[model samples]
Target chain A: MIFPPDSLEAIIFNALSETVESMVFEEVVINQFVANKWPQVENSAWWACIELFPPPISGEVIIVVPDALMNRFTEATLGMGDEPPLAEENADALGELLNTLCGRLLAMRVGPTHTFRMGLPKIGRGDTMTQEGNNHKLVDCLVEDDHIYLVVPNQFWDFNAD
Target chain B: MLKILIADDSKTARMIIQRCLEMVGVANCEYVHASDGIEALTIMRAGGVDLLITDLNMPNLDGKGLLLAVKSSPKLTNTPVIVISSLVNQALEIELNSLGVNSIINKPVSPVKLLECMESIMEKGFIS
Candidate 1:
């Protein structure tokens, strides 16, 4: 996966734009992102990631963002009111938002000639860890200041406790 | 024959873009697909991609990184890119355009409007 980065950014940025329109309507920016993860790496609190798979046989696109940003995202996504259910409600909304983003990405990529099904959304705890594998490409991005991490792989890896 | 590559994580988006480009009457045109920014780059690297359309937020490389990477490449020097999105940041948009994006298509896109956009940039041979 050592291709130029623009095309990949277009995929994520375009998907992020479309996903928000169909789902929540929160216009966002595709902020700059990097690959390494700390020490000799570059992971941060805003990191988010996802994996894509079969029929499509691709991988997922994972994304991460700060908690405060996630909170705002939940409010924007659910369109909740004064009675919004607090942190619990935000969690549910976050999962749904990511799910919608993934589903939209696959359908767009495969075109009318193919269809891909997405599994239920799993929200990673800020500290989730990822393993390396082939047939997979990782995408990291930011939306309106929220850090987003993603992956498109042929199979599902072990789920961390996030 | 102008070659166009559309990279997005959304299926609906791809359709909308395809329909829009058709409406613009871009004849003898080619449309390529990439699920994420990373794949988009891969497709472009293979050649014949004259215009690159992408979103800002995506898995793997995301939009900004993608834009930077593409512009940074010597091979893609002549290729033009269009940034279309709904991400809630204006500064990012300004930055992208300033960095040399040919145009910016704000979100909530439709077949009709997209077509109109294409028409704005239509050249002589795109239509019969």
Candidate 2:
């Protein structure tokens, strides 16, 4: 594995924290309550997915966020005060966030010299999607009162057997 | 007034980069936006673009193709290019440097980092 399970968890947390804080000036903390299942939210959620291409180690990173939190993020990102952001604006914000997050995660996992490519982020609205695999990793996070999730297949780190 | 062109498929990214540039004290600049590398190249070829700040991953031509077009043109070769991308690594950095990229900034860019990179470019007289 590229990193031990604990180390992988830490990397995910750090990457998410850095990306959210810098992009939207918001802090994120790991959600300790929901261990396996996706968080139950009253509002509909939006998700953004991006594919990572590192040759033999390929995987997808998905970020899920509720509508309200996403709206807040969109407003903060566009510097919109009071005025509501357009639908396309929200999608763009989520796409950019996922793009940045995926890149940061891959860089942390593979280090400096290794080269990687990522497909454009795909954003959509849907019920919570679940990954049914033994090699899936989830990092549930709380941005203020909202629950956000970062999901990826564990095989992405199978390159390093050490 | 400086005429700066920003090329990125995401509007949010372009806005953020523009905000970062403004935050770094780059005032009195006229900004042009393009959604893809082909559009950016066309805009650059039209003239009056003082600087080009682009994202590496984009539809149509992409940043590498845009950079190649810019550097190969005798008219646009002197115009400095700064790449802001999430997919930055040692190999990509080396390749971008070889292609005459003035600066490379990672995603979720802060004003301080943008300022530092701009300052370095300013020192080299690439951008005034």
List the global CA lDDT of all models: 0.59, 0.84
Instruction: Score candidate 1 by DockQ.
Output: 0.02
Give RMSD (Å) of candidate 2 vs. truth: 3.1
For model 1, what is the error of residue A114's alpha carbon versus the real structure, in angstroms, after optimal superposition? 38
Error of 2 at B68 (Å): 1.5
List the candidate 2 regions with Cα displacement exceeding 4 Å.
A1-6, A32-43, A128-135
Q: Native contacts recovered by candidate 1, as a share?
A: 0.00
Question: Tens-digit lDDT track for model 1 on A31-113?
Answer: 44444332112332333344454654445556555666666666655445666446555555555456556755554445444
lDDT per residue as tens, model 1, B5-112: 988765445655776667556657878888688999898888888778887656787777788889889998557677766442344445666777766675545556
Report how far off residue A20 is in candidate 1 (Å).
Answer: 11
